[model samples]
Target: MAMPTIKAVRAYTVRGGGADYHDTQGYHWIDDHIATPMARYEEYRQSRRSFGINVLGTLVIEVEASDGTVGLGVTTAGEIGAFIVEKHLSRFLIGRQVTEIEKIWDQMYFATQFYGRKGVVVNTISGVDIALWDLLGKLRGEPVHALLGGPVRDELQFYATGARPDLAKEMGFIGGKLPLLHGPAEGDEGLKKNIEKLADMRSKVGDDFWLMYDCWMSLDLNYSIKLAQKAQEFGLKWIEECLSPDDYWGYADLKRNVPKGMLVTTGEHEATRWGFRMLLEMDCCDIIQPDVNWCGGITELIKISALADAHGKLMVPHGSGVYSYHFVITRHNSPFTEIIMSAPNADEVRPAFSPLLLDEPVPVNGRMKASALDKPGFGVRLNPEVKLHRPYAAA
Candidate 1:
């Protein structure tokens, strides 16, 4: 069989202004949003786990071939470096072997040296590269896991990273956690309310549940320490991002204040192996959470997992879990995986690998288990029936 050659790649964006923020997770604390699916890009809210998960602009990359197969990749629009995929990336991919997804990733990463390395630009490269991997795998007849190594476990173990007041014990999650709050957590009375709320959730769910709290770059170290000390009573699995990502000293302090068992997890916002290396080298974090979207996709995710393995550490991928499911399924050593308990991102649910034809089969228990699309490439789906909410011209 001849390798499918890329013929064309097009980018599209969607924005919906002042739409109801129906992310549900955001409404856990504040009941302000309107809950309307956006038709086009909205500027304020992009896809993020913490802070505000408002829908802003969605970026879609469609790669077409002469054989009629097309692969689709998505990231939030309006990101600083996403343009590389939208503008310059297609030139290199127009007539190359889609199966050479790994080589394509390296080329894209190094090709953008002139544009200053790291952050959004490199991340966008990874997003497109992952979609292409899914495309390439489908072109053949193997799963993406077969390409990486092989499946470590049939079903991935996950924790409900987002918690709700009502479904404390009803939800059959291995672990559960309270939502993170921002810095301006009011005065002492407000802090008291936050603590009481967490305490109530714990009381409702009882022990034997691994609880997590996301700081989401909200609270300062001092406040985080106070909460961490108080939070020890509830038996949390980890207190995430108590300090800033850069504040190694704060992490060290928070780690010291909390019980030995309470983990200090961060790096969800951090990017790449080098960025994760900092978290590893300092011994600042007991657990590392790198978002697959922001991180350099599977190529770097495997490398980062290896780093964690060498350090005798644990790696749990962060947001927009397209790449995360693949990583968690293939790697045996990775400890715990996560699912956005609120609502999985729409883009996350979108099929990125259409040309190959696949599905990101979700777990029967509301988590993503393993890829059934054990074809030759990344087992992802690209739906031709997609109606672009905001096309480039339409925007």
Candidate 2:
């Protein structure tokens, strides 16, 4: 006889920070949703300047049946953690077995069908998928990355993200980029300052070190062209998000203008594999940064890398590199993944941050390495005692 499926799936959003966060009672008791009190650890995790900013406070889904067998999942939703579970996909996940992840994902897609696919719905699922993978890893005594296909690289090189020219060089990361920060002033003085940052960084860091600058979505064709011309003096390795997500023509034009060696990279907000394929077809980007959680999990990441390889582009997975580290380590010659070092208390979620999170925050001497872990799954272990704060409730 077939075993019974998960009969009831209830989710509790626990906060890890110290002290208690008052729940809006009016908001909490709607349907099967409930909130857990806050703890000190969680506040640090969710804090604007926490080291464990991105990876902590995952949504945990408990898959329990009347027979008592249980499965647990940890997922990423950035800051919108419980909202994803209690408000969005939690109800659809009832009655799923530990083995029914693919089916559950489909069910979630169907349930949230009215919201359309992408953005928050997809982000919520990304976290849920992470939780499922983690739960499975715990059940099997293996790390999530190991289950994905088995560990490959010995160490994952990390590039310090969110650095400007001086900070980038000072941190000893010769291989990273700074997000775009410019004002509306256009012309010679503005151009000079723009060019100077890159020039100064390259001068300080020396040659052979990779450097990138983020244009964000602010630059148009003229701005991109001007910046592209100025960037050559600094020998920038790549320019990220130089144009808007919708401006494929801008990329095409900027690509032609930015000389041959400087890479034009984008697509952190581009959704999934199909979105990436458009970039490939248009030859828009020399490097692709498909965020695995939002883009598509392990299954789709490999497919994306394969597509890039076939087309002579490299897949430099973006977003939370803590999780992306699994993908980076597995792919050969893939270098310089983004590391957004916030959440001051990083050790709360990723204990590896000590020796793992570099002083420079990139590979050693600007050549970081992905360390091998004896652990079974993603090599990340969570402190269950830590909880979530400010749980979202549907009123």
Q: Tell me the whole-model lDDT of each prediction, alpha carbons only.
A: 0.61, 0.56
Best by TM-score: 1
Residues 152-178 of candidate 1 have per-residue lDDT tens digits of 787676665554633533545577656
TM-score of each: 0.80, 0.72
* Residue-wise C-alpha lDDT for candidate 2, range 1-395, written one tens digit per residue: 35445555544444432111111112211101111111113333222223232233334445554455444434344345456567766666555665577777777766775874676566566656655554556556665566666546666555655444445445555465655445223446655776776677677677876777766555667877777777877777787886667777778777878877888888776765677788888888888887766664555566778888888888887745456766676666365566643323111111222222222223443344544433444555434445534455432
Task: Kindly report the root-mean-square deviation of model 2 from the true structure over all alpha carbons.
Answer: 9.6
Q: What is the C-alpha RMSD of each candidate to the true structure, in Å?
A: 6.1, 9.6
Count of steric clashes across candidates, in order:
24, 41
